[model samples]
Target: MLNLVLFGPPGAGKGTQSQKLIDKYQLVHISTGDLFRAHIKNQTDLGKQVSQLIADGELVPDSITIAMLEEEVDRNKTAKGFIFDGFPRTVPQAEELDRFLESKGAKVNGVIALDVNQEELTRRIAERHKLNGRPDDDAEKLKKRIGEYFDKTIHVLPYYEAQGKLAKVNGIGEIEIIFNSLCEVIDSF
Candidate 1:
């Protein structure tokens, strides 16, 4: 199984590359943000908790996020592997994910972090705002989300790095160029 964690700051093409990775690798894509949105849309018990935290621009606690991810993972018993996007944002969560996956006899094969600088991320997010009209894409919220990644999410890189499972790919280029770069990393594994 080729379990991968797609790591990066906001607007770093994680989502776009995740799709290509899924198509080529035949992996299930488990995006926590998408899962939270679905739960919130359905007004499930977990969604209620996540909705309030998200509205305040806060991350849902690790326990809740882990449980939600485990449920999703459990549902896909026959998946060849999984691409975990927008998850394991903190080191503790990374540890938890490792433990959970171990319980199921799987492990994270690699972490491909799209290394886009803040300036380019801002530009891409701004363009995404105009294209999608996502509420969180507004300038202030974008700043916060990006800040959170720098402050919190980046820490997880070292965790995977220590495990020799990290591949830092340049993330400022044409879509196919970046995807090709990511494909190189995946193909190596």
Candidate 2:
């Protein structure tokens, strides 16, 4: 299986690129944020807990997140591969993912990070706010989210890098252009 981790800050086009990659690779897109939203919308027990935490601008606990992810992996028994979009925000979570995947006789193929500057991300957030009315794009929330990425989440990159499975694609300019670059890296992987 060609399991992948699509890494990026918010508004760095992770969602956009993930769609393209899924179409091209026929991979299951396992986006934790999406899963949370779906669960919350459906009012599942897990979703209720996640929604409360998210409403407080807090992260879901790693144990809960990993259990949800494990269920997802188990559900997709015949998947070509999986593109993990937003889980494993910490090194420990990454370690957990590794162990979980190993149990399934699969492993991460690579991590593809969309590298974008803060200025560009700010600009994109503005556009997204206007286009989608995303309340989480407020300045304070953006700062916290971006700060979290740099302070904590970005550290996950090196864990993958040490494994020689991390690749970066410039996250500026046209969507297709960025996607083409990502395709190059993924194909090589």
Candidate 3:
């Protein structure tokens, strides 16, 4: 299985690239953000809890996030592989994911970290906000999200790097260019 974790700050085009990866590799795109939205839309028990937290502008607890991911993994056991986006946002979550994958007799084959400049990310997010009317795309929320990404999530990169599973990809170019770069890296594995 060619399991991959696509890591990057919000607005770094993780979602965009994940779609291409899914198309090219036929991998399951397991995005925690999408999962949370699905749950909230379905009004599931976990969804209700996460909805409340999001409504209060709070981060959902790590345990809750991990549980959702575990459920998804279980549901997709027959998948060729998984491309994880917007997940394992903390060191603890990364550890938990490793353990979960190990139990399934698999491991994360690579972690692709998309490196984009802050200004470019902000610009891209602003453009998205204009187009999508997403409630969480305001400047304040964006800043807070990016801050959290660096403070809490970036540490996960070193953990994967130490395991020799981290691949850094430049995320500042055209969409096809970035997607191609990511594909090259994944193909190397």
Ordered by lDDT, highest first, the candidates read: 1, 2, 3
lDDT for each residue of candidate 3 in 95-176, tens digit (9 for 90 to 100):
9999999999999999999999899989999999999977667788888888888888898899999999999999998999
In candidate 1, what residue range of length 10 has the lowest lDDT sum? 49-58
TM-score of each: 0.97, 0.95, 0.96
What is the C-alpha lDDT profile of model 2 across 36-59, one tens digit per residue? 888998999999988877665567
For each candidate, the alpha-carbon lDDT, in order, equals 0.92, 0.90, 0.89
* Candidate 1 whole-model C-alpha lDDT, 0 to 1: 0.92
Positional deviation of residue 57's Cα in model 3 after best superposition, in angstroms: 4.7
Preferred candidate (lDDT higher): 1 or 2:
1
Residue pair clashes in candidate 2: none
- Candidate 3's TM-score: 0.96
Q: Which candidate is the best by lDDT?
A: 1
lDDT per residue as tens, model 1, 1-189: 889999998899989989988999899999998899899989999988888777666788988999999999999999999999999999999999999999999999999999999999999999999999876678888888999999988999999999999999998989899999899998887
Best model per TM-score: 1
